[model samples]
Target: MYGIVQGVGFRPFVYNAAKKYGITGWVNNSGGAVTIDLTGDICNVKKFVIQVVKNPPFPAVVNKVRCVSLQYLHYDDFNIKRSSKESDTVKFIPPDMGTCENCLKDIMDKRGKRYRYAFANCTKCGPRYSVIKELPYDRRRTTMNSFEMCSSCKDEYTTPRDRRFHAETNCCQKCGPSLVIINNKGEIQKCEDVIDETIELIKNGKIVAVKGIGGFHLVCSGRNKVVIGELKNRKKRPSKPLAVMMKDINTVREFCEVNEKEEEILKSSKRPIVILRKKENIDLPENIAQGQKKLGIMLPYTPIHYLLLEQLDVLIMTSGNISGCPIEYKNSSALKNLKNVADYFLMHDREIYVPIDDSVVKVFNGEECIIRRGRGYAPSAEHMEVQDNIVALGAQEKSSISISKNSYVYTSQYLGNLQDFNCYRNYQYVIKHLTGILDVNPKIWVYDMHPLYVSSAYKKEGIKIRVQHHHAHMVSCMAEHNISEKVIGVIYDGTGFGLDGNIWGGEFFIGTRADFNRVGHFEYVDIQGGDAAIREPWRCAVSYLYFCGYDGKFIKNIDKNILDAAIQALNSSLNCYKSSSLGRFFDCIAVLIGLKNFITYDAEAAIALENIIDENVKETYKYKIRNENNVFLIEIKDILQGVLNDINCKLNEGTISAKFHNTISKLTCDLVLKLSKIYSISKVVLSGGVFENEHLLKAVYYELKNNGLEVFFNSKTPINDGGISFGQIAVAEAVTKKQSRE
Candidate 1:
């Protein structure tokens, strides 16, 4: 059955297959599913099932299909049946697909009718989610209804022998969207051609807002500093790095290092904007990525992008939407909201099926790193070992979901931060869409332990399970690698739900997918005003330094009295929340060393610390260890206290940051090494958001390997909370399966 199967040209596929097998049938979409009834000889019916099972179609991930045979019902030749209003609810939908090879080859074919067509597509490709407005996907329900089909195109669409027959998305220059060129006064301007006019305007330094896959893109020539600066000025995006589009991988290599992972990400079907380290010698302007070390780059995910840059140089293709909102895709809205921001609008009449924002990616340890999951990367299922079909609703902040059915776990694309109401509505929208696309009717559910998490409120039906925060993080890494074997999981992040009813961030749990023990851990320090310390690092420093030799009453003599007061208030608390969080430790140390007193972004202090460290300096830290209460402990406080004495030194910040990084690595290595002889855990997984720091990840990975241990790293998804939903789903599945087995 086809729910989202309507707009994606499902009828054409059924018709062609029937014709090839010499069978007669009528296929149509009803309610949310596409149904087909066949009346033919026994051989044809059997061939239908055989072929459908073997090879269905490109990009059509057939979740399942049921076949039934009966006595022949009298029927004539095969025909496309009109859609009905009712059907079973087992049908699945499909996400918006990129351009197909057939259309791509046709567009590139110089002699073909639709040569170099920017809006060219067939039944196999083009918009599905953005343009769709109702069930039983039809021309009337889509934006395509506005365009009357041209005579030539209509003939091919109706002809039974043609590949374009019944292809609803079938279009050409005669009946497709166009680029209208005009000057500042709205005067119609004349030019040689679309490419030439756009190129000339780009060379002359005009900001062109081009419509693409799920939304509009604000384009400007990267070479012109004035134009780029104007784009930033008008877009209200001065500090945020703008994603740049190059012609191909060759040009991309000139600006950034393209290893196998980076190259794979650049060429991936999703075509996400990949964050890469900028080459030191690149002559690009500084306005590209303000206050950031990496530049966001992407290859063309759409045909229009390739044609637009065919003549023009590198183009700054930022999302064509306003800040603090979803990307703009509707024609009327774009005209109203973006009219002031863009000088000229390169528009089209074809409708965008969805407002899917650009997918963002990065490379880590030679694998594709999905940061913002969208477009080509989403709605695809990941088949993993699980107990039951469980939907793990993710946390409130940086939300996404992991739904498991049968043996597969499908993680939804990046849903925006869930703090805003619009983002919340959008999260629900994505949930409905993903459920429709993958056909996941969860039999059970899982949620974050945090009661206030946005996704924790679902209680409509089924068995609900609340999973701890750090446990979910650990299991996510386990499920991604399908690790049934036992290992020591080091989950070090800012905050997580502790088993002992405390906030745990930095933890070492020794176990497999289902079993675990908090074998060894660091001393818990006060959080000092809860989340306030996360924003103001000085509060954390004040709390940490006060306990370790720095005067707790120094606030009377200090200029920043608020930091001292926070420490004072928290010092005498009856219930001081303590954590062994490695992430919190990093923040506290950053404040201690004068790198930062407050943070504007998450991980900014740690990222900047890694950015300045000189990798060539081969330095080792003295790690202190103790076996207390039959548990091994690495004394990180010793190094923290020692650093306070040398704060007056004139050495570079690189040396200081490197020393801390090395110290942390050494302590982790020492603890693991001591545990190896005592315990049989030879496998270790280095996970959490902190793994996003490549510098820190490198040191930990090498140190663990030197201890003769196998490590599982976050190469696919972010080790952060972004990937926690997957872990939650895995834990739920494992628990359910265990119960059934027991």
Candidate 2:
């Protein structure tokens, strides 16, 4: 058995199961794989194997189990032997798990040995990826090695009957790491009751930076408008929604409409921030999520978080970094960087080796779509049955790295955009960190085709393969489904370097990973001030208006100076590039329909547009498709004209947004059907970040399915740039094979 078996109580589970079936030998970790040697009755041994496979540890992912007829040494009973680190394949390190229910009860129970202990955890739950230094996942390989376990705690660990038997992270108040409260003046407050003092400060609406499992979170009372406003102001985040940490499902239901699926995801051990629709006229402060209709809510994942939430109803728990920078994990860094933002600090002694942010997820079409894969969801390998010794550097935005081993591509956590110097450094660090931990030395390096990309510039000592951006997006969807056959891929996202040397976003391609042909795409429009257009949606709106043959006089209510400059740029074609980006199209529509013209973050305008979608409005605007030498041009000028007519008719933004979305969806089906007739391809693959919009995906998915076409979108891997690395890996292998054949 392999894959996340270590550090997740799999050994104990095997021991318990073996004992139940009267199979005797030994079970131990050999690098990444769990080795079991047993000799007993044939039926009992078979039952033991079945039980092990059927009911492994909660967090363990048993990828494959192999049974062999071994010359077993007869033993009286089963025993967990010392782990041996002797294997070519490195073991998978489990992500930090949320505190389990039993441990929660332990901390709450007055008579319990770990009562009120902030670091109380067992084998089933606690920090793993964050604190881990090396493999075999023993106590010494973790930060817990610094803390000497007390006799009582040691007894719980060594006792086979105990739930925490061989639990590497088990600790009590007397032996484990302790917390300290620091005042606003950078002076340590001599307080015995740190939790109580921290709770009191937050109750009074004072913001506190609390050290958590992966990093520090700036927490304040969510109900208090002043505190929430202060947090937003200090963080330099105005309209972006702040995630809230609730006590339990009951508190979450009070503020947000909790469906059954969302409730389960919130309570799951991963404990990702589940984006839930807010209850109409909820009793919470409006400033908590501001203009957004949905609230990002998460349950306590750590013992300290649980302890804090036990007293508080709701807290505005957000990453403790000054917006745009990576999360603050080091105590010294948190104390120094967050001094101005947080009034007080609740810090712990336990060191976090890796800085992992909280993961964010949204329920889409009854499936959990990961927006930000971090914390409890990361450092988890996405397996692929491919050749080893390859590394794929992900896209410039939402960066992550993928290392391929025998049939497994262990992708790194959500490394922020490589655009920032600090985030670039984070990307570099994670590449080195993950490669070191996974013991991977790549012989082949894969990178994006864009020359200016920081990831492409990395000096890797290997054969390099540069893959086209949208092809990688399409291939990523293919790789997730393990598809080898060619399919019609409709890739829509912000931007990607096209093979024809233009910025391609809305793309239609038909092929396998080896090669792809651009069958059709949206007609190119001039992008005035390349990066500048991305920062401000108004520029895109003006560009689209100009493309629709609208003069400067048509740009009423918009800034005259900006409009004039954009028009000048478009007329002269100065510092302007052609792009067929669907993302830019959305941005243009978002601004045209009276959404935010300037964005504080990436995809802000698009998100606002998606949020205001009126699902009941099924009417789609007319669109034109013309084939130019087999490359179909999807003209959106007519769609924009329809939108203008709707706006002139005083239609609300929601209705316009609905019409715009439906038009795009219809256009997708129309283009696919046209291509299907020509290429005889029926498999339609939807990929890229634009598909992260559930409304658009659902519309396209159901429409294609109803039309007797098989539709496949990304489920295992991300549809965004986060999954680009995996696509890079797939393309690399396919290209290599093709080259070898040639």
Candidate 3:
């Protein structure tokens, strides 16, 4: 057994299983693996092994199980042996899980000892990665070590038949951490019942910073628009959507459309925030999710959350952080940082070892794409077959890190953008923590080709290799699917450092993990003001218009001074760089179709455009591809001209958006088919942040699959820069092995 077998009561489970099967055996934790020895009748032994493999503890994720014959040294009975501390820790750190159903029942039972216990947890669920300091995952090595179990809890832990037997973090109200309510000045309040007081504050429409498994969350009543607006104003968050913690799946269905898959995910053990489309005329406050039609919602995951939410309809649960800082984890830090934002604080004495944000997900084409991987989904290794130790420093935006050891890739939690000081510090801390915990010394260090990336600045002693951004995107998809052979990779996203010293985004590559050739790409356009152009779409709009041979005066929506400056900069190529970014093109179209010329957040323009896609319009605009010297250049002048003509004819933004999306999808499909014929390949992988757009993904997926091509997409990791570390690991490991052979 490889995954989540340590902190969870796997040994006790094995002991019980052995007793039931009448087999003599010994079980113990070795490094991170579970080692078992059994001696008995062949049939019963086989039954025991099958049962162990099939019915592991609810929190245990058994990746593989192997049996080997050993000379029987007769033992009278099976027993749990002491874990070996000399070996390197091989067990994966399971993410903090939501309170399990059994634990919930204990909390609800009035006569039970655990009734209303806010920190109620069993072996099957509760904090793991966030509480662990080191591993063989023993009780002494966790944050719960200081809290000695009460006599009653100890009795339950010692009994083999008890559900709490050998539960590492087991505790009752008498022994476990307690809740504390504090006022705005950080002074403890003398409340008889902390839960009731916290409920009263929230019911009165006051913001409270509630300590959770991972970190603190600023919470307010979800139904109160004024309170929600106040939260937004205090947090200095102008437009990004806020997530709501509903009472349950039933409450979610009332506010948003829930397919079976969405409902299942909402009720899952991970309890990640799921983005669902809002129902028509549902009358949800528009300020909750300002610009988008989708609502990010989650169910109460912890005992404290359930206790408070049971008294209210819903709560606005957002990470407790200022605009650019990481989520506050420490009680002192929460009080100091959230003093202005939160009116009161609901805190606990239990410490969080590592801060994590809530994971976010959205269903696209009936599959889940992880927008942000954290909390319930971090520190878990995905199995992969590779040689040597490797460290992959991911892209700058949506940054994360990964380490490869013994055929497993352990990706870190969501480390926010590398630009902010606190986020970068967190990134470094995660790197050190992962390396130390796994005892991995990477022989190869991988980074993006972009020289200015903060990740690229990391200095380490290894065979350093630089990978192109879009290529990493494609291989990230391939790694998730476990593809070892070559495929056609259609990579589209924001900007990346191109091999030719230009910014590349829209690209098609044909190759394996070791090497690839860029077979096709979008034609280059100038990004005036360089990085500044990303925040203001009008600069890209001007560049597109100029390249399409349109007069500057035609762009009347932009301010006169800004337009004049942009045109002059474009003509002179001043402080401008060439880019083949599909994202920039989308920005141009978004502005041309009358969306906001300026955006407060990244991908706002593209998201706005995607939100209004007219599914009824099936027509695609024209585009021309030029194959000069075998370097295919996809020119979008014809497409832009058609869009301009449509604008002149007074077309709705939805129709224009649909036509634009369809044009790209058709162009990509046409390119893939043409290349498939030329190269004799049938497998295609779609990746990059742009693929997060469901409309384009579905359109291209149908076209390619209908044309008899096997399509692959990202499932394990994100399609954005967050997945870049995984791709870097795959490519670097392969490249290192190839070089060693040479």
lDDT of 2: 0.88
lDDT tens readout by residue for model 3, 1-742: 6767887789899999999999897998777788898898989988998888988867676886766777769899898887775344355876788999999999999999989999999888889889988767777878999899999999998898998888889999999999999998979999789999999999898999999999999999888889999999998877778999999888898889999888888888889999999988775678888868799999999999999987997889999998778999999988888999999999999989889999988887788779899878897588888754788999998888889877889998888888888889989988988887787877889999999999878899978899989889999988999887989999999889999999999999998888799999999988788888998888888899888878666565677987888888888999898888899999999988888688877788999999998889999898998897887889979999999989999999899999999999999999999999999999999999988888888889999999999998886798888899999989987787688899
Q: Cα miss at 179, model 3 (Å)?
A: 1.0
Question: Which run of 10 residues does model 2 get worst, by summed lDDT?
Answer: 551-560
For each candidate in turn, the TM-score is: 0.82, 0.97, 0.97
lDDT of 2 at 58: 86
lDDT of 2 by residue, 141-201 (tens): 8888999989998998988878899999888988999999987678998876999889999
Question: In candidate 3, which residue ranges exceed 4 Å CA deviation?
Answer: 66-74, 86-89, 551-558
Which of the two candidates, 1 or 3, achieves a greater lDDT against the reference?
A: 3
* Clash pairs for candidate 3: 32-90, 32-91
Expressed as tens digits, the lDDT of each residue in 1-742 for candidate 1 is: 5323555566778788888887886888765566788877778878886775466666554555656666767777788987775533443334566676678788789998888788777766776656665556666766788887899999988877676776666778898777666543455567767666777788889987778878888888988888898888777765557889998888899888778878876775557788988888687877887646788998876678777778865889998866655676766777677777777767677777556777777876666766666776655456676754578887665567887655667777666667666667777776776555445676788888876666766665889988888778888888888787777888778777677777777677787666577777766777676776776766666767665657543222335566556656776862357767777778776766667667655665666667767676656556676667876565666777656644656557677777778777767777777676678778888788777777777888888887678888765655888788888888887777777799
What's the distance in Å from true for residue 381, model 3? 1.6
